[model samples]
Target: MMNGHFDTDNPDKVIHKGEYENSFDNMREIALAPNTHKFVLNFWTEDLKIELERIRTLDITDNLTKIKYVCNVRPYYYFQFSDPDGNIIEVTGKYTPKEGQFV
Candidate 1:
């Protein structure tokens, strides 16, 4: 699919939309090269607990061993897991910081 960037994940009826399209919608898409290496992907959300619980409910999901915070400089809550092929996927939530602490 990488040669012409074919739509392997999408349904047959739908094709990719570029910036010039009028009926465009915001949706997540992945660009991958045909290689043996795995990848890491991160996303942000308003609630970390909700997303964490959602992942927990999936019987086949695996929890990652990474830290609970995105960085040592700030308190960005996050969680990570691996796909079946071992590509890492992360989801994080941002909290308001006050007095160098987050709620």
Candidate 2:
């Protein structure tokens, strides 16, 4: 994962890597910083609603979480929440690629 890079030529390709920089607590602090907390994670599913519902049932608290469904520029759904150490996690539905867009 450390040696991997996202293909700039393909917007639909997703990258996966393990958390290796800091401990969960410190990562939480970094994630909370303005302009640094945003990390888009894509999940593939045939039924996005069902996947969303399953994520909603987890033991996540609302105080440190935000969820929304957006359809303006493109149609998609996502939820952001802080992990046990306060690091924000964004779980988003599959990607709908558009020409000239990086997403």
Candidate 3:
């Protein structure tokens, strides 16, 4: 039986009972690679507005690049941009990433 908080019909929510430990143990000491990457802390609600100030596009590609605007509890927007490393940066928005996608 699953906890009432989750729908019992959902397979992802189904788990064998009594398998969880009272307190979880940390296994971080042995298996992870030595720290070489800088860590960034994301504060979900702490004035994240500035992070989506502008959308910058580079080395334009044929694939579709656009932001999906979602308005619910918060009016959030998405901005998609390509970096010099060819990595796509998706920033939550107040505006769309591509000019054509905007009004």
**TM-score leader:** 1
Pairs in steric clash, model 1? none
Give the Cα RMSD of candidate 3.
Answer: 14.2
Question: In model 2, what are the clashing residue pairs, if there are any?
Answer: none
Cα lDDT, all candidates: 0.47, 0.44, 0.33
What does the lDDT read for residue 100 in candidate 2? 33
lDDT of 3 by residue, 1-103 (tens): 1122232234353332212221111123211425311121222322223443322233353322343443333455543344444344444434334453432
Question: Model 1 residue 6 lDDT?
Answer: 35
Rank ordering of all candidates by TM-score, starting from the highest: 1, 2, 3
Runs of candidate 1 exceeding 4 Å displacement: 1-38, 64-67, 72-75, 95-103
Q: Which ten residues in a row have the lowest lDDT in candidate 3?
A: 17-26
Over 14-102, each residue of candidate 1 has an lDDT whose tens digit, in order, gives: 44221221111112233443443224577888876666666777655654432254322333555666678766676777533344332
In angstroms, the error of model 1 at 9 is: 39
lDDT (C-alpha) at residue 30 in model 1 = 35
Q: What TM-score would every model get versus the actual structure?
A: 0.46, 0.38, 0.26
TM-score (C-alpha) between model 3 and the true structure: 0.26
